[model samples]
Target: MRLLTRFCSSFPQQTTSVGARRGGINTHNTNRHYNSLNASSSSAADQVPVLDPSSLSPSLTRGIHVFNCPDEVGIVAKLSECIASKGGNILAAEIFVPHKKQTFYQRSEFIFNPANWPRAQMDEDFLKISTRFKAVRSVVRVPDLDPIHKIVVLASKQDHCLVDLLHGWQDGKLPVDIKCVISNHERGPNTHIMRFLERHGIPYHHLGTTKDDKREEGILNLVQDTDFLVLARYMQVLSANFLKAYGKDVINIHHGLLPSFKGGNPSKQAFEAGVKLIGATAHFVTKELDEGPIIEQMVDTVSHRDNLLTYVQKSQNLEKQCLAKAIKSYCQLRVLPYEQNRTVVF
Candidate 1:
């Protein structure tokens, strides 16, 4: 808990096509990038971009833009104008201006005739406004027109979250290409998972680690060319060096409500504490263990009648949904980094 091949946006990317071990065996890439626009590439005179007939959406296609920049007057007007100028209609806009903060955060969804506004031109338009606002983060995505995110999952023993993610991918509820699954533990209790990965042609790596060596090099080699990593209850703590090397976002699911029962066997910790509430937390992975910004959380009621196994079961169920929902949100371009260790998950 770490991923980019950038095209001027902050989100990580891969090919329009995904190979089996490269991401998925047969993931659906329904929308091909239709760059039919025959425009000369130039912003010298700041003219409108010419549309490519091939890339044109026969109907209005939805586009998403997430921006974080310094707050100032006329920001909204400029944003509106940027889209409106290109024959795009703003369907919804959400802006967050934190109190006593210089930061400005916005997530916008709009519909545009791709014939009038080419994909490349949209990027240029956003780039111009982003530069003017001195933005720290800027990303625009047309889910129907761009590559689906490619991700790798790291787990140790527990396959609840991992299994759920696999099912989600299969059901198409989670729009992603799972490059592979990496684990430092044996498949002793996870034989079915092994069979599933084998049958589906999804690569699964079993790299054993010890106190002397966490097998960082092997993990890095496997994770190369990925958009991001998911810690599906990957027990080991990822080192700062590994995260720095990867330089992308890492999402992890904590078994218990974070800041409460962190660092191993949280179910037992919560049980010992006699707490009535048990939950799971999905968040960005930082070098400081579970201290990263939370993206999603889910809770379930527990009482004295509940036993340790019951608590564990409930936590596992929550973890599966929490992690899956977080991944879905991230892939939809609905997540953005905000102020220190916090996120603007629209």
Candidate 2:
């Protein structure tokens, strides 16, 4: 938005010496007159251009802009032309149209030179483009800080995964803000999870679930204030309504390789199956359980001596790594949803 100008210069010098000896006084000045002449001559050479932010016009900030439009050749062409006219560049985009919805969504990063065009004129130009394409627009500024993503973690009586996340956040290893911790079970008021939250000053919500709809209600309430959701070993299955309400905002870390040991006791199931590798998957929450778009997945080799306990340990480690990676990708806006999955640009 603001620009600064810099200047550099070089100056020549001369030396003069004055001394008094026993028999005579000696004085010497070499090139003194020449140095003064040269200094005067080079006075203009030291002058540099000055840039005043207040005197100049403002420029547009860098950010991402999302557009939802119709899936038609004419519409796409018109959109592209409009963007180009406004000097907007498309960095990355994905188009998804299922069935006859006729809806087209795109995410693009563009540079808005506010210095060239005033803020009002810039908005006016974008408004005209939106009207021409009959689209909805949303702009997100490029984060200037540490870019810590706000994550609302949900857990039910599980401490290992939640503890790992806590430690990661505390050590600055995970660029995340744990907005709150929601749990379905009441492990007293002084449990490990509660104590960790207290230590970090993060809010902890204990939404005890009893009825069939209780879990859904609690999860929905917790997600209301969060930018995204992280299910860190939450054993309960979320209701269909909850998943639809949150859409792709929810991410789950499954302790087993997806499309294989999906349900319960996945580690034991893997060991029983004599699988050579044990791993974890981090995926978006969809209508179908464990079938959402996979953001990240990792696996570790397993030997014959690996028992159920060893497999669980390995799986937990993999789960933390995969989930953290997925969260980081989401925060960086590098994960894009495609047909039943996601494309991680980074």
Candidate 3:
């Protein structure tokens, strides 16, 4: 079965600007120019404020709970009632009902004194509610200083997206603990990407693949402990069985806007098609290649003057930006899967 079990959604809508950080350890300072806190009002009914992960503080943030079940009345009311009984304050909530499927999806955040609402007890109590609705649920307790999501990045020879993610983590831009970097390509021992990762003390693993190797077995072992997997332009095609085994939390950055230009050599395809707008899509990886639920998408206008090389360069930049944005949203607990093939990201 295709499971939609994942974390809650919605970051603060308002965030302070973060200037680009210069390279090298001497230039990096954690205190200089932190992003603004992404706190929301006490009521989930109010508009959600945007949150900058760099600006979060432990005293002000709340925990998010994601729940989905067969559509019926009082799911929200009952859940809210339970939370209220536990002295939890609803900070923000997003709910959706896919009419055709008769299913409900909800992501809600609440502030409660942990001393009063212990996680173990809360889970025990919530289980009854879940069973009553035949629900599937996940709770992500996000403390201000904690790295709630752990990521493992998969890359190939192309390191643009991988480099972007690494730098973002180092500069305190993306709110995730990068567990490690895995690459199918040997790329030799002295590649620039290897030197850069080693300079920053990030773990890098090279798993060279042969045509007959059981590559997926090794990958599965590596990612078993990770919360999510990121395909930072990894060129290998994974089988449907592999996707199912991995729990389907994998996020991939496609260089082309989906449904228009898909598969290899998208830039060349777009150039031949003479499309005016070129774009990138970030989505959950599924068995059906490039057809997974999309989390975020971005586009850039193209002109006749732009040749294939120029388009490639510009689209590479877009790929980095789009993937980073989607990763941030995923880590912030603001992405929700809904309506079979769609996602609702707040």
Best by lDDT: 1
Candidate scoring better on TM-score of 1 and 2 = 1
Report lDDT per candidate: 0.76, 0.61, 0.71
Q: Pairs clashing in candidate 3?
A: 9-334, 10-334, 12-49, 12-50, 12-51, 13-49, 13-50, 14-50, 35-55, 38-51
Per-residue alpha-carbon lDDT of candidate 1 for residues 1-346, written as tens digits (9 for 90 to 100): 1211111123222211111112322223321211211223465354443344356566888898888798666676787788888888665565555545656767777779888899999999999999998988888999889888899999998879999999888888998899999999878535889888887889988899999899989999988888888999999999999988988888888977677888988888889999887888888888887877788888899988888898889889999999998888788777766546566666
Q: Pick the candidate with the highest TM-score.
A: 1
**Which has the higher lDDT value, candidate number 2 or candidate number 3?**
3
CA-only RMSD, every prediction = 12.9, 20.0, 11.1
Score candidate 1 by lDDT. Answer: 0.76
lDDT of 3 by residue, 1-346 (tens): 1333222234212211112111111112222111121324466555344444345444444677777787666676677788889887665565555435666666777666667777678778788889888986555554553455788999988889998998899899987888889998776558778887788777888887777774888899888888889999988777788877887588899977776677777888988888888899888888777877788888899899998889889899999999999888777666766645766565
Per-residue error for 88 in candidate 2, Å, reads 12
The local lDDT score (0 to 100) that residue 62 gets in candidate 2 is 51
TM-score, candidate number 2: 0.63
RMSD of 2: 20.0
Q: Give the C-alpha miss distance for residue 191 in model 2, angstroms.
A: 3.9
**Residues 167-286 of candidate 2: C-alpha lDDT, one tens digit per residue:** 888998776789898888676767777787888799888787775556676567667756778899888788777766765477788876677888878888888889997788888776
